[model samples]
Target: FGKNFLITTHYASLPWLDSLLQEAQEKSAEEHLMSRGIAFLLYTFLDTLVDSYFPVLDDIDEIIDDLEDVTVNSTSNDVQVRIFRIKRSLAQMRRVISPQVEVVNALVARTGKFIPAKMNPYFADVHDHLIRAFEVLDSYRDLMGGMLDVYLTTVSNRLNAVMKQLTIIATVFMPITFITGVFGQNFGHLPQVEHDNGYLFWIVLAFMGLITALQLWYFKKRGWL
Candidate 1:
């Protein structure tokens, strides 16, 4: 029976179980050596995997901080380009981080086979860390949303300021245009049409009317009329 079981197990690649069995066989006086060896092997494997995963989570946190800085302090077209790059980086990070969460969850929900009963609490702790990482990611997403809103509002305010300046300029020049147009007419029976002083008189009157209209408009716009 032992020979047949060994033959059947040899057909599959269970390196972890093989290592445990080999170790138990090497120790001649061990009681329940196979089970003890397997338990130790599983604990060490989980420990190594969890240790490796933590560095990856730290890298993700660093990326989030860099993205937040770029999004919040950017003031040029370069900022838009940088924001797109950061978004892509975050997407890639999410892809990796989500699977890690699943892996931790699976470890926590293990039956009696892969993980020993004593190791369940350690895996549960890892699951808690993964949950915290997901929460941090959610908060970073919210901050990015707020930064985008502020950027749009800043652009809108600048546009409104430009429009207001143009409107004020147009208002200031409107009376000058009207005065010039009225004096340009070639009517034969006009009041100032027959004297040398007529041209001078019309020019002075037009200039005076333009100045008065401009002053009134300036006063109105400045709230001092």
Candidate 2:
């Protein structure tokens, strides 16, 4: 069974290696180089891989900066939504980056004939960078998470403040509403309905009540009540 599996794997690997060999041969033929020039060929392959990943790293860095901007400047719900979208994009970027880290690690782990010994350190450096990138991403994720929490708390606090202001306004108007409602009643038996000083008395009482409430509110605001 192992033999059969090995045979199948060998066959599968042949097409891929054949393609690599064909490309190497074409490039070598263009430069009129021999198969013994494996180091140059390996260098070309590794360089191409490194170059491809550099752009990915640059993109991730750009995304991190954008996310940082969103986290900093976000105020309204719309901005929060944008921040969340940035986070989603960062998450997707990490998904792509995480596998690339493995690819680098795999390259570093291999003692393959294709990989030159001197190039291993360079690959290891790249792998280290991948690790650092992941760490930075995690830190940024935590920062953004904290930022989101702060934003939510700020919004809630603002809402609470608004509610308190509205409540205080309602409380301030309660006595005025009560006085108006009582005076507006068309009851014929009311004593104030027939007295000349009755309107003035009610007006003075309403003013006094309003003044008392205002003084109380002012004292409360200043923490001096």
Candidate 3:
């Protein structure tokens, strides 16, 4: 383009540019872009590139929606992994695209040999698309952050629930444990140890059962169960 001739090369296939090139080639003969010069073609190329990002953003939107629905019930590590991965992807996209937004805006503002004054509206349109992309990306970043918070909160709540259950079990066994400890003593004067008919054993068992039932009933009444 600097030598008044458009030279192009690609080490990797760019599907977006490929389609754009195809269309441009088909229009070259009829549209006579050669008469308007390479500036027009450059604008079209950049415009196509900018337009490709929308489809990707749309797909990200769908993924975010799905994640939000699953985030409430999902406790798997996969959800966290996906959230981080998408966040990194969005960050990379923002880094790469942000400068391009400015560049397009600059192109609209500055008229040069390659960028004509008459094409400001075209470049401005590209700028608008870039701004829209930025808005979507920023919103997705916020959503990803929110999803991460929700996942952590869910995990914390589950942990608290487990701890509560364990604590309740311990509480229910506390008096029973004390009763057994008292009977387990080696002292001969311990109640029920001097019994010859083994009636004391049944009494101790009944007492323990009674304590357990009472504790459970209290817990149920308090809505702790």
Candidate 4:
């Protein structure tokens, strides 16, 4: 197994793992990691695996930025979908990275003949890289949680705005609805009952228009719109 590299995984659909291996191979070509011995090669592979997390996390950070923008300007259902999607992605990353902490620690703890003394320090360095990956993953998880909270709050505020708008519209029309209802009555003793198309009707219409304009102006000045 000295010169042979075995690539085995149950997940054939994992393009990320393949990509990491490919990238590590490219870097190794430039730096010649093969001369660093077997244990060093192991460290290099693990370090590459850990380093791949950073670019993925960067992409996730970009998504969080987009989600935050959506939270402020819009409350579409897609925001909720994206929030959950980010959380799930973070969870998956943790699943992959967390156990590697233990794996790297075990590798550093080994004192067998297979692991040369000179490579112990290299394994320790890889262990540190795994620790940093775990820390960053946790940070990303917390960030995703905070974004979820902001998204929920934004949705709630949007709902309240819609309700408030409906309330305002109903309140502005209440008096006009009452006046019209009364004037539409079939009673014989009503004052404006016979004046269907006369001065009283025009006066009521002007009064309603004035009240509507005043309400709209008041709402605008209050910055409710």
Report the number of the highest-TM-score candidate: 3
Q: Per-residue lDDT for 1-225 in model 4, tens only?
A: 244453445645556566756765777555655655566667766776677778887888787777777877877888878888888988998898888888888878875755777777888887887787788778878987887788788889879989999999898999889888988887878876475568887898999899889988998999986
**Residues 1-225, candidate 1, lDDT per residue (tens digit)?**
121122223466655555655765777665544444554444444444445555655775686567556655555666666556655665675676688778867767775644567777877776676676666656656655666666666667767878877876676667777876776787776665567665777776778676877777776898743
- Tell me the lDDT of model 3 at 142: 92
Candidate 3 per-residue C-alpha lDDT over 1-225 given as tens digits, one digit per residue, 9 for 90 to 100? 642556667689999988876766787566865557777777777788888999999999999989888889978999899999999999999997999998888888898877778999988988999999999899999989989999999989988989989999999889989988988988858655886489888888899999999989988999988
Whole-model lDDT, model 2: 0.64
Best by lDDT: 3
Query: Which residue pairs in candidate 4 collide?
Result: none
Ranking by TM-score: 3, 4, 2, 1
Report the alpha-carbon TM-score of model 3 versus the true structure: 0.92
Clashes of each: 0, 0, 0, 0
User: Which is superior by TM-score, 2 or 4?
Assistant: 4
For each candidate, the alpha-carbon lDDT, in order, equals 0.62, 0.64, 0.86, 0.77
Candidate 2 lDDT by residue in tens digits, 32-131: 3234345444434444444455465567567656655664545577768856876786688679679978877887787555565676776787777667
Q: List the residue pairs that clash in candidate 2.
A: none
Question: lDDT of candidate 3?
Answer: 0.86
The regions of model 1 sitting more than 4 angstroms off are 1-75, 186-189, 193-225
For model 3, the stretches where C-alpha displacement exceeds 4 angstroms are 6-11
Q: Each candidate: RMSD to true structure? A: 8.5, 7.2, 1.9, 4.4
Candidate 2: clashing residue pairs, number: 0
